[model samples]
Target: MRIRIVLTFILLATGLLGCTEQRATVAVPQTAQASFSWFEYQGSDPVFAEPLAPDQYQNPVVAGFFPDPSITRRGDDYYMAVSSFTYTPGVPILHSRDLVNWQLIGHALTRESQLDVSGARGSRGIFAPTLRYHDGVFYMITTLIDNGGNFFVTATDPAGPWSDPVWLPELDGIDPDIFFDDDGRVYIAHNGPPPGEPLYEGHRAIWLWEFDPKLQKVKASSGRIIVNGGVDLSKQPIWIEAPHLYKINDWYYLLCAEGGTADEHSEVVFRTRSLDQAFEPYEGNPILTQRDLDPSRPDPITTAGHADIVQTPDGEWWAIFLATRAYDQRFYNTGREAFLLPVSWQDDWPTILPAGETVTYRPVRPAGLDNHPVLEPLTGNFTWRDEFNQPALNFHWSLLRDFARQWLKIANDKLQVQPQAGRLSSLEPVSFIGRRQQHMHYRASTALTLSASGLSAGITALQSEAYHYYLGVRRSSNGTTIFLEQADGEGVDIIASEQLSVSGDTEIGLAIEGDKDKVRFFYQLDGETWLPLGGSFDGKLLSTQVAGGFVGTMLGLHSRLEKQDI
Candidate 1:
């Protein structure tokens, strides 16, 4: 909801809009500006809660497109990191005391020098990242799909200025995981091509290599194929990825995701007593999956796999994995989200979520721990707003590609963004910054003063490189106009347009109201009255299923210089 203010349009005289190679600060009306509302965003909506039990919590421990969750614990503190894929400052590092509650502390990849995602499309940059803490340093190893093959960064503190990529050009695979054995030996486990030619199309193998931490490279002579053709070669599982090694007692457990990370994704486990020997498949493989669950079940969580397990201080066990909640049996606009489930050992093998249970909306809290109040981002309900008063944007906010220095600035109690030379569809980084949608039904609005003569700026529900919806306020010879633009693979199309009376000191409000079915665009001169600018557009256009990507919808502010050269 917007604050209702009825004030005269007063154009403060300034040459802020026409300056080049410099920044111009503009003053906003005192009544029109308000401090940004603060709220903790979790999952697709505000976190779901039960009034009866304050200790109980919901699935999606970390929400909104946070996938391939890898967690580790240091004493009472717990840290989890997820794949950020093409977003700048990739691999979000979240911290928490209890696993149910989490907050974005920092990012492992902050500098552009650490990641090169020049022309990479959606879902093509970073894959699943394995976060491990060994000795006094935090290690994060991941695949830069199209950029470089594999690399790892290290830092003493989880919230870090992590070191640059120690590129493993010799490693030829994705979803890399690192293991530091007790005997001062380090190893890297990942899915790669078979020893020679594959028997079938998706016939991949899990390979292991001895890693030298001092040199930060793989030992060439120590390479070996651990698990070939997945669990059962006859059944032939596909895309064995996201491998993690764990040593318990005298057994080394290797867990990896198979069945292609789609609806059929499942976690399969293998164990071996020695690294030199091949790992044997567990009799009860696929310890976690929902594809075999009853289809008639309500709000089923599909695509459940890519799991990583962590033990609590109290000796309790838990598994953190990725799953997607489908709406109306088939539609799922919220991308894969992180889910937590308890793990119980039976006959030396781990079982997840019991025999017939899928992911629960509200699960029981871990035993023996005090019923502490729910924390931020997991506290469940509040509205989020940013005043942009701080020197830097919040850790949760990310740009499409590398951070552009000239794109945005904080000054004069307003977020000043210089219009960039490209549209949201272009591969180049534009003047856009956004957080994930995180909600099926919500309202996001921003107040902007379009000072430039030909500049247009507003909010967008960005789905991918070729698919998105733009609700922008434009200034031209015809005065201020609200335009609704849609960009599919075909091209950009203006679906609706409306003229506004406001001229200078253009305090126009633009909002995108979203529901499961559609998204509607609106504009307001006075915050009280909103005029619908475009017809309700189909929400499916932004879904991962329809958009064909590994990313979810991002709703945020964007600006463009209509005539600037790219």
Candidate 2:
């Protein structure tokens, strides 16, 4: 059966236009910002249509800085894993059924012993991983940045109490994936530094070895070279990484991502009749590439590779892969997210997104399926506005580091944050905040009345340990004033600041509009017209390149000592 899919693109008005539509032109609301509440408030609700579920199929199904997706299917269930970079609780596991809707399951690695992520640089923590199920066990194999190696873990359930990582002593390089052959022998394939190349050359070539699940070691005699990036023209001499093996009928298929994972990144596939034989390239090797998509639309899916194939209970085949969506010219709020594409077998080879060049919209739902689950709403009436009367921290608030018992207190309808001496750049601050990067355009505002004399308090949009964009009200020697600061590679800079009247209590508002890359600071005198204190500060500080960390931007409040030596 032939299916024709039509995708319609809608551009929502940002702050540049007014708040309503008259006939043909739509006015962008002045208050529109980059928060979940702002998106819902502006009536820019997500639609629940099929190809892409309006509400659930947000641009990045997996938000934040997650990248290099590897998914596996068990019966009607789906599990996905991604490169966690420098985040503490690495290897996040997501569960889904329809591929479009996903829920965050428990993290696979929780302890520092399993993966020492402390001081790991941006884009350099846990690399690409493969999630697979063999027998009654779920297995994951990945690499650790700054640590010399690849490792594997197992759990009885995908939403797991995963085991401690078993380091593969002989295995080297990154982007490790596992394949359990039909004969019950498990094979591990990864992109390792090519042979005879300089030891400093971190570039990878595909290598395979027999992995023992019992001993959790790479058998020395079982190692062999599979493919090299320097030899193949289409594969390119760049870095060939994120390799996964699949077996269909009598053929073993090898899939790897090439071209450096930037704008030129692509998914390449090849197959071999025997597991040990040299692989033959696919006639139409690059099953997927975004180079053909309209360059004007911000090409939501960049670096689209690191894919894994799975078959549903109904025998429908699909591939889950990682793709990044750009929020602006250079920033991606959702990071690398999980995307699904339908797959077809043509002449004993696999084809992905066969209907067209790019996945403009959701593909046709597989036939004979009627029990698809309903997608959940990604937005709601939630923001930084809080009464502080609750006994516990709201679900929206998460500490920069792990949550400790002694860092916060709630009583007398007030939230008191204990002053800590450490700088915010060390991820040691006791501050906590909410994170939801669903919309490219929205706003977040909060009111805080200070009670301490020597403490500095303010709201901030944090990207990582060292990078942040903040518009905060603090008590200087001149009295309470509003200041906007941004952190680039060099460090934080006060881009704009203004002195405000001192009082027993004051109201400070901060709004960040993601699309326009602007932030506006406002203060209300006696609850009147919101006087704008600052306007349109650049948000380039939130980019991964400038920010130099693995986490996406999160909105939250913080307090620090007036002096570093405190």
Candidate 3:
């Protein structure tokens, strides 16, 4: 199984679609008597894979919304970063020592000027990134599809005040990687048009240019097409992207992802003795793949490509790549998650997950590596509770994108979201902060106080830009009420609701229970008593199978107003 916590988000304006929704009034106290502790759901089956034997561990070294991982080692310390898409903190930087454990360090792109993805669609902001350390400086080169095309940011420290992006308008495509040769020469490679197009279907090539660090641009006269149409000219592979250059011994090896980012995704390699000579394709192409595996294997992981290789201090090599864990056969809502696999090199060519073998949950730990501190569960199961008592939310929490303006704050032991006029499904940022759903069977709840009429705050199971379910409390001049709403292609539908006699300072509890098959919504006035608010809804509606995107489900607190605008 693949574990991912993702935040490729897109927001919409509230109430703009003019869909009629049901409303109800309820009575609740203004203050919560006690805070409820986060509890795991008790089910017949285990929520997580059993922990590995003391000597062994799990794949998905980093879980949740962490994908397209590019890793670099700096003196026994390993630093990795992943794609964040349209999320405000574009590239999430993580630090690890053992490769099995990782911690969030900081983002490489935090400023709107550095990387502005405001109003960009989900999964359209940032693509793959290549993180490398040369001398004392750290360099991250990536493509911001929504802003400028290709750019690189530099920081002396991995936990960084990353420099503003140095855009390379000369680099014509995405998935860019920088390679520094031993002879004091720097090169940049990317998936771009061959000198001319229109050769055949799926016609794409890997282009390279000599990069001058002092000038922060590509040397125009040094451009060359390295590999055209992938490994086999007769096969015609599509989307030969995500290029990485590695020089071993005397050969320069070119590694890239071919096919697409779907089930057919695979990694292919090529090598050459000289920089400008014709590169020879590996006789055994597609160094990594899962497309040929049996479809009926239980809890299969498909789309296993777009991989990056890293070498440890002990001479052990591992490949970090993106894959999906489908729930109930072909439905996966977790997006593409980072998976770890050991790499074995024989005669200068590397292979992943041996012939006739698929990705496994418990891979033997690399030899001679000391284990790092385990801060979170590797099985993607845990109890998380936030009372909003801190000055700022934890780094683990994420917002959809940088809002047009600030609309929320943390104060008075609660997260106060501005009452903007809109629905929870609005395109513009209303008021939302969320975390990814790491398990199929889990419980999520929140306690809140609503002070004004026409304001609502509660929990949501957000799948994408146009699909989600909301369990919220709406206040009106008459009384307060709790309601359950679902947003589908037909627009918003109020499935069920209940009225309560609530006034100022009243507190109410909302909860969501999700299983592999369906989800149930509930609310409570007394902390111990939960009243079901709606019938079980089809859980597959929120699955990527039905939602169709690169984002997983985000569960979080959201508030909307009926007559206010931000």
TM-scores for all candidates: the values are 0.90, 0.79, 0.89
Give the candidate number with the greatest lDDT: 1
lDDT of 2 at 464: 61
Best by TM-score: 1
- Candidate 1 similarity to native, TM-score: 0.90
* TM-score: model 2 vs. ground truth: 0.79
lDDT of 3 by residue, 330-425 (tens): 676556778888888888888876655788767788777898875644345567667677886666666776634356666677676655444445
Scored by CA lDDT, what does every candidate get? Answer: 0.76, 0.61, 0.74
The worst-scoring run of ten residues by lDDT in candidate 1 lies at 3-12
Tens digits of lDDT, candidate 1, 1-566 = 11111111121012111122222223222222111222223233433533536767767776677889999988787899999888887899988787887888999989888988755666678889999998888999999987788999999999999998899987888889999999999999998998788888788988899999888789988878888879998887788888999998789999998887777889989988999887999888788888788766776778889999999878888999998877666566777889888898887778775545678878898776554443346334446677676788877688887655565767776777777655676665577777877666767787788665556788888887567888877666667777787865445577787778886675777788887768888877886788887578988888877777788888888877552210
Task: List the RMSD of every prediction in angstroms.
Answer: 8.0, 11.9, 5.7
lDDT of 2 at 432: 45
